[model samples]
Target: MKTKLICALTGVGLLLFTGCTNLAEKVLDEASVSGLTDKQAADGNIAPVYARLPDIFQHTTYFALQEISTDEAILPYRGGTDWGDNGIYLALHQHTSTSTDPNIRNTWLLLLQGISRSITAINTLPTINDPASKVYIAEARGMRAYYNMVMLDLFGIAFLKDDPQATSDILRGEAAANYIKAEMLAVEPDLLTTVGPGRLSKGALWGLLARLHLNYAVYRDRYADTFTHKPEDMDKVVEYCDKLINSGQYQLSKDYFPIFNSDNHSNPELIFAVDQRAELNGHNRLAYFSLSGDQFPIPAYVGANGTDGPAITPDFYQSWVSAYAGKDPTVDPRFYKQNLSIYSNPGDSCVAESAFNINRGILRGQQYGLIRVNGAFVKCPDGKYKVGKLFNTTRNKPTLPVNFTEKIDFTVAGSDYSTGYRVEKYEFSKKSVSGRNLGDADIVIVRLADIYLMRAEAKLRKSNDAAAALADVNTVRASRTVTTPPPALTSMNLDLLFRERGFEFYWEMLRRTDMIRFGKYEGTWTEKTNTDKQKRIFPIPQTAIDGASNLPGYLVQNPGY
Candidate 1:
């Protein structure tokens, strides 16, 4: 028998977990597992914890907080109407976000729910007598640590709790970092190496360890002008990265796009990711969010269209242009991948017999997608789709060509619908023929390329062998096996490594942390000008603070909020 968790959602859309500690206890309605075996019960108890990842990492929540806060991406109000969201995104990009901001509040709630779920699993899984129960318990602990790591990174505090009914011991800074590290270390041995990237595995644990150690200094002193990367932490980063590299369980993806393709669950490069198969309520927002409103990837269902959301900053795009010198950024395999050739010629139209595909990577100038004819997709004679140059379809800008400009001028009146260069790195899922909700792509949390780069950063910071670090970066650069791969760097430094990270991992929601680590988070880009160090971590949601107000110092807001 499989145990089922039926959670009651409150009026405010928060999960009212029943019999749970540290919050309002409405209690979760759980199905009894009286006749279930220990292994079955253990598996069932941990499922909901894993299920919380999709919502926590959604585009409008954590992804918005991470990417919109950085220079890599921006979400301006389109035509003073769409995505206005009462200037929540504008505040996020401008680094003036508050505790009441929806994104912050939603992220905090989801992350805490994930932690709570993990704690619930940890509490229940131990009672089972089977040996698998121990492993499940270890997984629960590891997951709790991962959630806390995100919590600490975002709000500068990690809620540590063993019992569901007890108050959480809020650890900040070094204490939080140490607790996360210790949890992963303690559970590392029990984690299975052969498990898939979606679960808590030895490889995932190692990757998490490397990430924790690499960013350990940032956690130690988040607002410091320059982080003091301790030699020991650097050693740990290198060690874990090396372990991952030598393990041979993962490899660098030769084709960069497949790493984020809808059917990427078995991709070896993924050490850990959110398993977002089409069957689940996964979202294709990452692909759809940054596209032009006129650009519709799916043809079968005319409803499946882009939201014309965020786009890459010109400063970020210029970084790629500068890195390549005279050569166009598109020449680099990682920069762009052209999948559709319908509009290759000026006055040409091609029949997309199977799937109406679009180009991937940083899109600039004119865009192309399915054209609409009286509220329906224009189709060829044979019932195939005909592609054409895209025009603005939303915000009453139908005649405007969907030409993405480099510079965005957002003002009190409005911003252009197609201002910033859009990024379409993740492929539009074939499964999402009808709408944007059903995305199958596993949201990549950790991959081998990141590991290589982490190792390189660790080695460089340690000042042991700059040559080895350069080699590692070159190794990653060489992974792009295009007609002419990105030229290997002649030399490597922190600046170059930082740029390389942007080239490899842009629009993947890692930019904010990267910018902070590189000490460029305070630098101005486009509309963002604020440089206050306290803005490093987002303010604790006012609701969270207020809810715990009775406890006095329980949920303190981050400084400089």
Candidate 2:
């Protein structure tokens, strides 16, 4: 049975379904809407557009394309068998993905759903005479522009449609960029400023515009030998960034971990985020994705363990070492935060505690957590709990201690369960007691630190002002209030600023575009040695191409595949 939804307009109501990935092209049957109030109509139409976000931003979908494909993260086939998934993940990291790759195809479908849902809301919201519907319509337009921006970034093409059953107008290069920019500009005045980061407020639109302009050079000419950041584009980036910076609505977070905590709804740094409040359509896959199989974060449920997923690449870890002049990267508050108190003493063998606390940041070396015996957690003599060094529970090597190593060889012998250092940035939600599904953390889309970095990059590229760029970089560093926040940099350059961004937003999924903009996408790192420029933008999924085959030249695959 399909889940049907009523897209309530004034008199005519369209029957839509949850499984329709491309709602824009679907011809709907007309149904009469009886007694829906303005609030009910707003809720029915606008909420689905926002609901599509959690699926789009899932770890196996967009995060895989954004983070795992770059040097920031990698998911090797554990024990030469697990996570192989027909080599899809390996293909992505190696720049060998095809149109049939499920991750790529799924990402395309979900992004289209976002655009489709936004289109549904945009077309229906105007019929309501309530003043709030106008704001909802503007938000829908902003969301549509945002989804198109991501589409343009990944596939080098965006589909625009105003009517429900109209054929989408395919756009690319300057035409697509200009269309998205124009839509945002037209809806700017109608967007509200007071709405929280979950919705597209005026500030969030400004942030999106800043992001679109910051990467404007790449979107304009994705395959250039070297991207040229025009002065006007850089100026636009700076102007929009300054609006969010001076708006007095947001601030840099003092403690970096709280910004990703489950209770971070009131965190002051978020400019735009997907609201996972009350575990509404929430997921714990991100928190559980990169953890070791034996290192469970939720103690109450033995089944709530990790699946031995992706880990941080050593090449990315070297960036932090190079930035801090060979000092321990833990000195930088952004790199690590020690929350587990049992490890206060290095030699403490057994602690009688049951709290499920784990340290954050790049988890390397020996890992310690609760031990299980006979399908139950081991308890101390005092009836609390016993902590022991973790071991490989899923793989055949039960005797091997769970010591995460820095060097991963991507071979049968080397790429075991504990090859690369895992990332535990997002806090595991305490609400996930029996399983790793319920999470409440609002995933950040845009924040103030990114704004500052955009402004700094614009300053460097626009006018070669090193001093001004240095000030902006240091402002972000000093805001991390720790025992010693990452010490202020006395100097700054393009390379230094790029490294700074990696430190600040490691698992936040901004690395792929950052690498391309800095002209480092072709550089070799670890298992990836391909220097093909065609791999910059992904190939359009074959399903999408077939879906639009009725209209000639409606959807064309990218140049590579």
TM per prediction: 0.93, 0.94
Model 2 C-alpha lDDT per residue in residues 238-292, reported as the tens digit of each score: 9999999999999999888889998887898998998988888755478888888
Tell me the spans in candidate 2 whose CA falls farther than 4 Å from its real position: 1-33, 346-355, 433-435
Model 2 steric clash pairs:
none
* Candidate 1 stretches greater than 4 Å from native: 1-31, 35-37, 129-131, 346-348, 412-414
Query: Which ten contiguous residues of candidate 1 have the minimum total lDDT?
Result: 11-20
Error of 2 at 177 (Å): 0.7
- What is the lDDT, from 0 to 100, of the residue 534 in candidate 2? 90
For residues 1-561, write the lDDT of model 1, one tens digit per residue.
333444433222223311122333223334556666777777778787788788777889889989999888888888777898998998999999887897788788878888878888888877778778878888889999999999898889887788776667889999999999998999988989887988889999999999999999999999898999999999999899999999988999888888998889998899999988854855547878988778878776777777878988888999998988898997788888887775466444656647557889888898887888678887777676778878876556678899988887476432678788988887777776555766788888999999999999999998857799899999988887744678888998999899999999988878888888889989998789999999999998777666665567656778887
Deviation in Å, model 1, residue 157 alpha carbon: 0.7
